[model samples]
Target: MTCHICNTPSNESFQVKVLFKYDVTYYRCHECGFIQTESPYWLPEAYASAITSLDIGLVSRNVRWAPTVEAMIRKWFQPEGPFLDYGGGYGLFVRMMRDRGFPFIRQDQYCENLFAKHFDVTDQPAGKTYELVTAFEVFEHLADPVATVGEMLRAGKSILFTTKVLPNPNVTPETWWYFIPETGQHVALYSLESLHRLANRFGLQLYSDQHDLHLMTAKPINPTWFRWFTHPRKVALYNYLHSYPAKSLLDHDFQAVSDSVRKQPLKDLI
Candidate 1:
């Protein structure tokens, strides 16, 4: 088999049962330290429900990460510029970021946009690139990892994403909680080294926390700035200070919607 990130030859590493049914073979690439399962034939059944039931932390995860992303945006990215959330499940994070004053658009072909309506990528004007594109907890599920990352790069200059790196040395479907065999959604997994190769493949600089969060950009950044802003205390303290108060567009959005409601022709309304 071939590694998706580096396009190098990979060897069969192990086998694990997925979705409680199929025994899946996993391949590991020595060149880039990437691990991937055999072409996910069970994915159609696996994703019958786009968000898996095992994901109980969905709300809390979004809540916890929003502040860090906000801090990162204010410091490194265009704070008031357009952004996109690729594979954004249910638009929860999109709504959270919008409320915090970032103009974020959602893009998820499978999931419904329950919270952030009128903000789908499909609703946006064409040919416009974003300041940043985020894909949290979505990379592990990709069948075509290289193609998906390229698609995100085409939409934005910077990519900020999160995925638990496959543990080193001693790793197996039994040892790693992230393996998530029951859901069978985690097909492709990356190590920190693999991620660096992924960035190098696209000629982008990478800053990683070496846990879950990572940023890839064409622009030069002092990695220290990224570390500081992403600290939990820093995010909290920055919000507390409100030195540059968040320019929330809540009222503006409401008024715009109300005006559109008023302008509709009576016959068309019915």
Candidate 2:
């Protein structure tokens, strides 16, 4: 098998019995440190429920990440342009971002846009570009990483996505919890090396949490805002404070509150 990210030859590392039926062979590319399952014939069965049972943390994950995403938009993008949530299953994240007062749209070919049906990209005219695109938990499902990223970049200049990077070089397919063959959905697993290869391939600056969240952008990112929002408590607090109801006459008072919060020293986050 050839590596999905790099064209180098890959060796079969191990096999897992998926759904107590198919023996799925996993391959690893020494050149790129990318691991992939061979020809996922059971993908349809895996995707039967777009939000799988294993993904019970879906709503919580969105809630945790929405504030961070909002901060990212505030730091990097203008407030007016469209924001896209690609591979947005059920449009939950889109709804979360919209609730934060960020203009967000959902785009998912597989899942139903149950929550944000009106915000679907299908409503937009063809050739519409976006200020930014968020594709949370979408990278691991890619069969062709480069091509899929190319498709994303064609839509926008930057992409913020999440997929836990394989942290240890010694960890095998047998030991990694992320390689859940029962779902048969997570096909491609990447290491930091693989991510760097992708960054270099696409000429994008890669920013990562050394864990699940990652960003690839044409321009530099703001480190101060990045530090402020990446913290779970800070994100939660941002979401909480923003949720306060404000009257029209007290809009300036609310703006003062928001500015004071935003300008708080980064040291307080520690």
Which residue pairs clash in candidate 2?
Answer: none
TM-score of each: 0.93, 0.85
lDDT of 1 at 118: 67
How accurate locally is residue 191 in candidate 2, as Cα lDDT from 0 to 100?
93
Give each prediction's root-mean-square deviation over alpha carbons: 2.2, 10.5
Q: Which residue runs does candidate 1 get wrong by more than 4 Å?
A: 242-245, 259-270
lDDT of 1 by residue, 119-212 (tens): 7898888877999999999999999887888989999988999999877844888788998989989999899988898898899988988888
Mind sharing the TM-score for model 1? 0.93
Model 1, position 10, has a per-residue lDDT of: 91
